[model samples]
Target: AEVCYVGVTSSAPSSVARTPEQFTQKLDAFAQKRADVHGQPVSTHTIVSPDPIADLDDDLIKAIKEVGADLVVMPTHPPKNLDVIMPSHGGKVATHTNVSVFLVRPRDG
Candidate 1:
């Protein structure tokens, strides 16, 4: 299967001091490394928006549609409060997108 990594970044000025080009280069390097390890070609796309974090699912859905992806695999973290019904970014994406979504939770310490 082919691999495409999409990275979203902020368009608004930030204190992080990293240029969009630098961020894109970092994403490319990381994607290349993963591609090398997986022994497959990996393409990368970087999206610069005013508030990618707030619209995470939107960006993800857009990228998936643009790439014509049938499935999406993304990392997700557990909610801080179990009582809250707030959906995670992955959950929001899954609900909004037409493709299958695979959410992987990271191992806790």
Candidate 2:
């Protein structure tokens, strides 16, 4: 079983708009789904940082390393014009971190 650390960066306004509990629940559900599919127990640590793209890559890197993550997974919303390209921050973290990164595209209805 591998432990997972889910990091989310939100601006002040966004944070104010959403509750941490709500965010954590969503992440927990995600982790649980992965665990179910893998048939392995997985634990998750949800973090609400101010903004990894703006203020906290070093800290994020350290935390991810400390948690012994096998990979970092993030949701990316690419611009409509460049939907084929991954988000910039996804590239930045993938380039900067030692761990592998998986960028999941947002689901469309």
Candidate 3:
């Protein structure tokens, strides 16, 4: 059973209180729901980060390294402006990290 680390990073100002706690609460609710459906073997972790959510390639790489994760599976939302120089965050993470990244594009409804 592969362990999945679900990360939600917030770019909110540092003065905000209970931000991480709120994130944890949300994650706990989500995990509980999934656990109820999937039974005990469903392994998932919630990583609540206070740093900026976008373009934190180095931080992502470092964290995954600490956990000995060889692969990073992420979803790429369609970019609002296609002309932006840098690719998606997942793309940048691919080039910069010492790990492998798998990216999936969400289909528009």
Candidate 4:
């Protein structure tokens, strides 16, 4: 499977502890580890945006297309009541993208 790992960083100062470079390095390391485990080639990409979570549908879609991914596997949590009022980023991506998307909720350790 063609795998593309994407990371987003914000320019504005906030409580985020990770720097943009650190975030990119983390993304690269994660992709490398996945590739090693799956024995498949992987690519890493980072997007610098003002809002990391919001307004990322377009960028995410573009990255998906650029990677020519057949399926998108995204980590997402169960929806809350507030999710009805404002959809999550994964929800927006599913709505906008044409490819198949699989949302995985992390398991408790």
Best by lDDT: 1
Model 2 pairs whose backbones collide: none
lDDT at residue 70 of model 2 (Cα atoms): 73
Which prediction has more favorable lDDT, 3 or 4? 4
Q: Candidate 3's residue-wise lDDT over 8-97, tens digit each?
A: 556453343346666656666767777777775444444545565543665676667667777898888877687287677787778877
Query: How does candidate 4 score on lDDT?
Result: 0.79
Pitting candidate 3 against candidate 4, the one with the higher TM-score is 4
Q: Clashing residue pairs in candidate 4, if any?
A: none
Minimum summed lDDT over a 10-residue window in model 4 is located at 11-20
Sorting all predicted structures by TM-score, with the top scorer first, yields 1, 4, 3, 2
Q: Please report, as a residue range, the 10-residue window in candidate 3 with the lowest summed lDDT.
A: 9-18
Give the number of the best model, judged by TM-score.
Answer: 1
Per-residue lDDT of model 4, residues 8-97, tens digit only: 677654454357777777788899999999999899888778886674777788788777878888888887899999887788888888
| Candidate 4 runs further than 4 Å off | 12-19
User: lDDT for model 2, on a 0 to 1 scale?
Assistant: 0.68
lDDT of 2 by residue, 19-103 (tens): 6667777778888898888888877665566665555555566667778877887777756655356336667678778889888
For candidate 4, report its TM-score: 0.79
Better of 1 and 4 by lDDT: 1
- Give lDDT tens digits, candidate 1, residues 1-109: 8888888888655554277777788889999899889899888888887787777778888899899888899998866785267778888788888989998989989
> Which of candidates 1 and 3 is the stronger one according to lDDT?
1
Q: Show model 2 residue runs off by greater than 4 Å.
A: 1-5, 9-17, 75-87, 102-109
